[model samples]
Target: MPIKSLLILISLLLFTQNIAAKEYKWSNKLTFLGFLKKHGIPQKTYYKMHKEDKELIQEIRAGQSYSINRKKGKITTINIPVSDELMLQLKNSKKGYTYKYVEIPYDLIERTISIKMKYGFKKDLYRATKTWYYGKELEEVYSKSIPFNKMRKGDRIILFYTQRYRNNKPYTSPQIDACLIEIKGKPFYGFLMDNEKYYDSLGRQYKRTYTTRFIRPVPNMKRISSRFTHRRYHPIHKRYRPHLGIDYAARSGSRIVASSKGKVVFKGWKGGYGRTIEIQHANGLKTLYAHMRGYAKGVNRGTYVGQGKTIGYVGTSGRSTGPHLHFGLYKKGRAINPARYVSKPSAKTIKLKGKAYNKLRKLVRHYRPQFRETRARKNSIIKKESKKCLNCFKKLPPRKK
Candidate 1:
């Protein structure tokens, strides 16, 4: 199990008579209204909230624990995490009750670890780091290129990674920026690039592009007219606004495809999004294609479509000024940057070229010195651990005298 899950499960809840703080796990079948009613909160709270905020209620998942604090037997504060980066905060005071979306504050911790395979990779990693996640991460980042199962005792694993922490407790999984796994005395390395793809010291990639769950709706856009933003001042409205999606510059009649296979939950005009289609995909992800000129035939609510299936066309609808597609991706109920999720990968392994490749090489160079100091241990790592690998030794036949 990841350390994050362990912490959440084992963490204690503090409570008192005059002042009390308690935690409760969200039930799988619980609805937002159900939660409100159970907690003695007014159901009017949901009906009064903004449309998007109302939708965010769907972000809360089953088994997720939330906190509630009370003073003098009355609720004082409540905090429920809706997403990894955002939470729903409710406050009750003499002024009355109120709730709003707030950003989740977490400290980013960067670390470097080197682990020697004393017992086994999985066992040692858990003993040293309390996580089998890194082991799987290494296996994935070096998939097809390196066989981690082939590693013998004494084989070392080094990683430069970062993780997020909230209230001194880990939540998200650690992200490894660079890794090295010594197998049979040969050093195999992987470096994470800005694009989130992994490459080796020689700039060779083993990941298949199409293997990603999500792909760009507009395959060959000329350029992104506007990128995702948290908040900005609207020129026309003269108010703070947020473009929670990417705007792809294309002709009005250009095709828009499904980012992944999913069932369409909505297909219609969505306020400022204009004509839109929302698809519910696996893992609680929903992709929105807005400002569409037209929807494809037979495409409607409850329609299931495959990845890359044409669903609509580009257009300047709603508040849009020009012909383009506004693409938004949401996980649970929070908007997320699509750059990491959307890809236009080909079938073969991707190799950086020209400036991109040059930049990658520079990054590799920066990481070289950091890991080069451990290269001296490479040869010693491949030695046989006969004590553990007893089968590795040839059976001694009875000598005939």
Candidate 2:
């Protein structure tokens, strides 16, 4: 072929290749359902995808981007990023549209964060670490001892955690390995332990106990709306009466677990206490759960429930004003304060002598420096910002003529 004809042919081939591999970006302004409709995806295809993967029904948030791959104006594939580390993909093939849930690989990064609280401990932790989910996990780790709501300004916290990243950008919140909260200048340290439990610096488990006599009924709830008191004005009855149980304030439908391994003595409605369940444990201890929405499947009378087994969910069944679990404890058929029984552990510290103690000490030392440096840098930035604001204020002319 002549040179001129060959050049024209090459140009045409390049253009065709570009058209065949074209890409387009789309944002989800409405729900995923609306997006599917807008994209002209058939209802049958959508239903099939939904049936295969229930997560397909999850609504794509506004401003989230999805990429489309087209070959000569016909879409060949679509990729929707459900999260930083997970992508939901649909591809057009000879067999029809195929759905695939792909996990994007992430780099694990270890980080240390130390901050002095100006607001809530949770809020400060999130601000310092840029991890919103860390608050819930940290709260759960420290809920047994630390009164997070009662934390005051200037309380300091140091944490060692791991975060997932893709291309140096964070993908998920930090998973705390160890943390230390200084409340009133007294440091309380929590370290991750076996079975994903938290233990104190002295090696005592936070939520778990050495002895199985007592465990937390509701693991996630941290706030106690009402405690066992001699006499208090009843919210429903509007009269002074002796309150036997402690009311743990949690969202409705929150899991309520068995405090210790026990037999379900009663699992039916009690007149005053709505949707109540009673369990008779070893050592003549009986626990009662009231104001439950419903019982878990197969959790009936005479069912042998293990410790931490979810038996019911929080609800306002009978004599309750809001969603809370009314937890009661009885010893040998005599009513007792659940708080005393729940908080008072048989052992305070797990003995970690010799090699175990040495290993833990080394780990703490390795992570402590990173947190200190981060805290120092943050303090320096705050000081500089404050000084700059003061200078700007001074440079301003005196109040208008």
Q: Count clashing residue pairs per candidate.
A: 0, 0
The candidate 1 region of ten consecutive residues with least summed lDDT is 384-393
Among all candidates shown, the one with the greatest lDDT: 1
lDDT scores in order: 0.73, 0.65
How many residue pairs clash in model 2?
Answer: 0
TM-score of 2: 0.41
TM-scores for the candidates: 0.56, 0.41
- Deviation of model 2 at 337, angstroms: 30
Task: Write out the backbone clash pairs for model 1.
Answer: none
- Candidate 1 overall lDDT versus native: 0.73
* lDDT (tens digit, per residue) of candidate 2 on 1-401: 99999999999988787556433444533655566677776556655643214322232334655677777677788877644334667788777777755555566655556677888877886676576767767766765557666667777777666666565876544557777787776777777643144667665556533233677788788599887753343454343334567889889999999998899998876645668899999878999998899999999999999989999999888643778898888766545667655774444445566876665566556546644565555451211111111001012122222
lDDT of 1 at 303: 97
Q: Give the TM-score of candidate 1.
A: 0.56
